[model samples]
Target: MIETNVLTITQLEHRYGGVTVLAVPFFELARGRHALLLGPSGCGKSTLLHLLGAILTAQAGRIEIDGVDLAALAPRAADDWRGRHVGLLPQQLALVSSLCVRDNVLLPAYAAGLPADEQRAQALLAGLGLADKAHAMPHQLSGGQRQRVAIARAMYTQPRLLLADEPTANLDDRACATVVALLARQARDANASLLIASHDARLVAALPGAAVLRLPARGELPCAA
Candidate 1:
């Protein structure tokens, strides 16, 4: 998960319920560049994101990121790799309800066995306009604030690759634009590649220079990994 370069994938495929769900012939994203995984609801956009992030296994394929073969990694190794090298803003925005905003942002650092920096976490929140909410619990934050917290958490370790799933689906038009711009700017400043999997067409227009990785037709069946 940690290294130079962005991503490399070839002949990727996944299946569920005895049916093929995703297939990708080949794809790659360079470091500091942006990529969008565009597909319909059932086209396995989420599944492909999971596969690329080492959160799910594919039936057959090869995915190499930062010179590490994620598909070949052991489960613990995969988790370690993700913890150290990958930053993910999952579809669920999985924040701990009991943790304060600052603690939530530091979770990734703690998970990676690195020292959590209070000043850095505060800076991240302040930059994102959440400086005053640092001590607030997740339940007390608005949906948009929670999403920003998730983004801050994903960035605590300064990951090499940042992955997001349906990031703008729940926001209003104004908020959507704001979130997209924030994500692209932060990733660029951090020197991390940003990959967003979303069906929203607005994203393509919003991220002008982003490479698009549209998933293949959902008819590719292969044996499970």
Candidate 2:
């Protein structure tokens, strides 16, 4: 049997404004595997996630997601490919202020220029216990509800690689477990590889069969922030 990696980073070195902030020797996540990135707030966990998501370009490194080298693609090409192949839930969620929950979840499909599947979007919302809030705005929902909306949005496209940045942050113990389970289940159902960057220990314990990547806390925030 041949093994294929869904996410790979080699000699990754990222700098911001003339300072070296993140340097990762090597990392790999195979398809359908769940991996947790553990680190302190300023340890470049988020930086690594952004790099994998194609939000930021690494100064010196190789990043291959689902076999495509991210550094070689043009910006628009990268963006389009990411839209089609990667499901990203950043720390901020980045939900549109004006769009309702339904539309927000559908944003990825829309951006990918794919036909809208309202049924799929609603189904995901229902699974996340946000069916009633499908019409609600971001501000109207609680933090956990909003987090679920983000999860739905990320899963809407059924991506091959799911990158989550601190998805369990700010939630209580129960909420944290719920979100982690949802993410794990959704990734399994989709056969997508899940790579989460978080400082939450409970999250680390909750993920079964998940490989871990740990980063050290370096006191100051990265310049890329």
Candidate 3:
């Protein structure tokens, strides 16, 4: 059976301060599958994730997430759409250090004018082995633990699309496996499509039938971002 496209891109062009970041002519992500975007640093992998998350506006071309034309939405509308259907885990994790782990997970829904479902959030955290850390602050957790919290936060809303940048960069082989497993399971449970940008070979190897997007080296035909 042919899976419906969860994300569709055509002639996606993006620039930052006059430097072209992405010039990918075509790309598509099928629903309920996990895809790996592989490339070295400065390869525009993260930039592409950002665009998909609607964090950055495309300079040209079309971006459709779950059949909605992203480029056509107003800035506020785009942000709302992101909160509603897209979960972005940037390289930084971007957790609010001041909030407890569970609160951080619930923040997204709160921002979107949706009621927080404590049961669902707790279930996701528990599945990630973070049930005991519900009240722990971000500063209290280890790197892997913090990363898991970020993942839980992304999965809390049951988004249709999940975009992660360098999700396993800091994890060891075993930890990487654990993280990928959790992400794959959650994405499937949520009926969401996951796109991850990472340089970690182990992480890519673990994903089932992952599609790779490798970027040309710097100055190699001026590969955009």
Poorest 10 consecutive residues of model 1 by lDDT? 216-225
Clashes of each: 0, 0, 0
TM-score of each: 0.90, 0.91, 0.92
Model 1 over residues 7-104: C-alpha lDDT tens digits? 88988877787667887888987766799999778788989888988899888889999888887899999988888788899989999998999999
Alpha-carbon error at 190 in model 1, in Å?
0.9
How accurate locally is residue 8 in candidate 2, as Cα lDDT from 0 to 100?
A: 86
Residues 14-129, candidate 2: write the lDDT tens digits: 88787777877788887668899998787888888888888889999899887789999899998988887789998998999899999999998788788999999999999889
Segments in model 1 whose C-alpha atoms lie over 4 Å from true places: 1-5, 216-225
Clashing pairs in 3: none
195 in model 2: Cα distance from truth in Å? 1.0
What tens-digit string does per-residue lDDT give for candidate 3 at 78-153?
8888888887777899999889999999988888878989888899899889999999999999988888899998
Give all candidate RMSDs, comma-separated. 3.3, 2.6, 1.9
